[model samples]
Target: MSLVIDIHTHPAFFEAINADEERLHLRQTCLGLYKTGAAPLAHIFNQMKYAGIDRLGLLPLDLTTTHGVELVSNAEIHHLVSLAPEKFIGFASVDPRRKDAVEVLEYAFGELKLSGLKLHPAKQKFYPMDEGLDAVYACCLRHNKPILFHAGISLQPDAPSQYARPEHFEAVALRYPRLRMCLGHFGWPWVVETAALLLKYPNVYADTGLLYFDSAREFYQHVFTRTLGQHWVDRSLRHQVLFGSNNPRFEQIRMVEALHTLGWRASTLELVLGGNALEFLG
Candidate 1:
């Protein structure tokens, strides 16, 4: 059987919901927006089981200063990874603005034993190429762990969307030539720039996240045939494409189905569904 990995997810976003009283009031919080298909840990696993997701890249957001939501901490992610080592791959998050951010990242990798790093530049309010992150990038390069960056627009009210554009990644891509970086959301409306980066930098990649929200045909036309063209999409897929559900915001099974609607050949389908992720995360 082919393996499937979801490289982006906010499983611990609503960690407070685990509390009895908070669970009852979950409908009132910002997380309540996902009340429809989103469920507790057990139900989330059930969904993954039904969707044939063998593994997931569980990401914790460190938006403490920006959104006052530090619910998903590195410790929480570590606990989850420890609980289900075979199913969950923890990706630690650290606000680059913090004084000891580099130390925290070192602790996450050396002590916590996390697999990778996930950053939301928009919420974190920093550019991907910010010189302050050089230490963090160097640490990632030393550990050989990939970094998933939130690109394009952000939903956070505190975010200055300008900080998250795909073009901004070029500087980092050029500086850390061997550092593996996956631009999340395929940079959405900036898919062209995302595609260009994928072509220009051997270590740069992207995931199909919110882009699948549109119909398969529309998505295909806009991303592949219309904007970047079929040839560009095909080449990029062979090298840098990875499947992602952006779960809780969207269903995993539905995202899988959406990829099938694109009508890629058997080999390409296997790669996009899981093969690329295995390589990227390695």
Candidate 2:
């Protein structure tokens, strides 16, 4: 049997909320592209079916303070998982700057039984290696839960691009050598830093989420084939790459097909498609 795990997704019940100019622009851009408002749970399941995905990972964003946009809370994610335990695995979020942040994460893991944690440094207005975040990393390390960090540019107007750079995450990876971490979006426009981390640290990995988007395909094609050279793809990649569809932005099945265009070996294909994520989630 084949198993495909889409490890990065922002499945949400989106609603109009207050936002800065940048946030408003992003909202309009998405609305123009996807031509929809909210991606309710039922619609998400139908997309999963179309993609032939066996399990879906749902990530919640916690940018209440920085973006002033109300987001799907960890509690809501837990409830969604409960609604369809067999189909969904929820990844919780906690803004490290929040008071009692570690405590909130403890409750999320202990009470909610969330499968993983998602961090967006840019939106949260902290560098990934910020000393203040040590406590949260300690929580994840102790709980043996993987963290999916947003490791690229964010559309939020106030977001600092530097905070999301993949290299900063190298410091955290070094500090907690055993903690599993994934840099989502292949750290686009910084693929070199993202690839270097993947090769240097056994615990660090990346996902092909929005890389398959129409605008990003050319960039990824160059990275996989030309920019980094073939060895990067044929050897350095191996099982460190994972399949992820940032659903609603890109269709999952189409993302799978986009990856197939690379013409990787059968074993590499299997690992990238699902095997790697299963091992990471374990």
Candidate 3:
């Protein structure tokens, strides 16, 4: 089988602290990271082995000092990725409001040799399309790096304003068409809208990170059999969708199984499994 690449997962640490009821949330979130087989700096390799996630992007999320979401520091993420170079891909998270935002980007790209950058507007407390992001995008463009932005749902129960709609990225993409942007979770609520944007900006693409794997398969199955005919699978076979298990939320291998159960065309399956990611990240 071709290697399975989960484009959006955090093999590195999460906000392990700062929960109101740390003891309880740890029962799920922190301890749950362990259940997902995600680990801190030291155990990443073993976790990857146990989880059978051929490749995982050690994604990080940042907080803006206001919303008390315990966010991971980019420094910690850089250290983790440096320890195990190949099994992981690091996307350094940044606080757009940080006075040293540009400096952080340089350190991450130049010194750490990380793969990309991750931004969560909801968590970072800024609009992805806000003019504040212009310089950041220019920096990424200069280095030819991609960005993974949380465009769909808020992973936390913080203030509602934390959630940003997918179109929030339209301005940025339109302005910096040269910069690559990967919408995590396929920008769910705006999944179709995201797809439309991809047509205009080829630099934009997304992966099926946390899209309820089985449900995704069934949905696609319906599209294949009912709406688009039996060849639908063959037709969408070339689309840019890639399979990803959100780890702590769901297991990786289950995603692999879901695709197989849907009877996705072999070539298409290979593409979604890892082929597309390899090329996209290239």
- Tens-place lDDT digits, model 3, residues 1-282: 688788887543343322234433433453234333323444545556664667887776666455434355566667666666676677887788877788888888898887888887765668887777888888888888888877777554442433567787788888887787877766765666666666667777677665443564575454334543465434643456666666656555555565676666788878877887776675
What TM-score quantifies how close candidate 3 is to the native fold?
0.79
**Model 3, position 249: C-alpha lDDT score:** 65
Give lDDT per model, in order. 0.78, 0.77, 0.66
TM-score of each: 0.89, 0.87, 0.79
Report the lDDT tens digits of candidate 1 across residue range 1-282.
589888988774434334544533432254333344325677667878888888999988776666565546798889888878998889999888778788888999999999999998987889898899998899899899899999987654556679999999999999998899999988877998898888889899898876544764466556756677766656555668888877766656777776766656777878877888888888
Residue 117 lDDT (model 1):
97
In candidate 1, what residue range of length 10 has the lowest lDDT sum? 23-32
Candidates ranked by lDDT: 1, 2, 3
Residue ranges of candidate 3 with Cα displaced over 4 Å:
12-52, 68-70, 159-163, 212-239
**Pairs with steric clashes in candidate 1:** none
All candidates in order of TM-score, best leading: 1, 2, 3
Q: Number of the top candidate by TM-score?
A: 1
- Show where candidate 1 strays beyond 4 Å: 13-17, 20-38, 212-222
Pairs that collide, model 2: none
* Better candidate by TM-score, 1 or 2: 1
Cα error, residue 192 of model 1, in Å, equals 0.8
